[model samples]
Target: MHQLDPQMPPVLVFHGDADKLVSPRQALALRDRLLASGNRCELHLVPGGGHNFGQDVPAWQEKSRALLRDFLARQGLLP
Candidate 1:
């Protein structure tokens, strides 16, 4: 977290709120740290979602794709 550069590219993060493998608080902390360093970040917490929550769910998969597409478009990586 301390090694981040303010000039680094924007970041988009997605974490499952109910994740067991990794605490959701970690994502919040990361978002805070990135913002504190003057970097752009977007964090999304999936409700009732656990680790790899989108893998087996069709709806989640589409949602994830939409989120990624939107993020990329915002970053000018997609049109």
Candidate 2:
């Protein structure tokens, strides 16, 4: 993780409660670790959402998309 290039782009991480593959806590831990290693990472925990995050389209993934849009807008990723 620490080996990652510092020049990489800022990242936004989203996790869902229904994810059986990986615990939501694990996602949070990774986010923390990234921050600790001086990487910019934002994590959002989606309620009633799963690992697939309503896959195939953004509309299908409102929880993740909404959070990401708000974060990105705050970060000036979009006007």
Candidate 3:
């Protein structure tokens, strides 16, 4: 892991529990590291989910979309 800047912007990370290409543990580790450095971070773990979530998008319904919107709004990326 690279050195994190405490003043860096907030980060949102999504990872699938069943992802084969990337380990979800890594995402958690990064989040922890960022938190330790006093950086804003959010981690969302999709249960029984894989790398691709196209099919699961519907399952997520509007919740994920709302979460993204809220995150963006917090960073002043949304009006």
Q: What value does the lDDT take at residue 47 in candidate 1?
A: 82
**After aligning candidate 1 to the native by TM-score, how far in Å is the CA of 22 from where it should be?**
0.4
How far does residue 78 in candidate 1 sit from its true spot (Å)?
Answer: 0.6
* Residue pairs in collision within model 1: none
RMSD of each: 1.3, 3.4, 1.7
Instruction: Give the per-residue lDDT digits (tens) of candidate 1, residues 1-79.
Output: 7689899899999888889999999999999999999999999988878888786344777898899999999999999
What TM-score would each prediction reach against the true structure? 0.92, 0.67, 0.84
Residue 72 in model 1: lDDT: 100
Where is model 3 poorest over a 10-residue stretch in terms of lDDT? 53-62
Query: Best to worst by TM-score, what's the order?
Result: 1, 3, 2
Candidate 3 stretches with Cα past 4 Å from truth are none
lDDT (tens digit, per residue) of candidate 2 on 5-58: 556667788777678888998888877877776778987776766787676234
Weakest lDDT window of 10 consecutive positions for candidate 1: 53-62
In terms of TM-score, the best-performing candidate is: 1
Output the TM-score of candidate 2: 0.67
Candidate 2 local lDDT, residue 18: 71
Answer with 2 or 3, whichever has the higher TM-score. Answer: 3
Candidate 3 residue lDDT tens string, 5-57: 89988999877777888999999999999999999999988877778753555
Provide the clashing-pair count of each candidate structure.
0, 0, 0
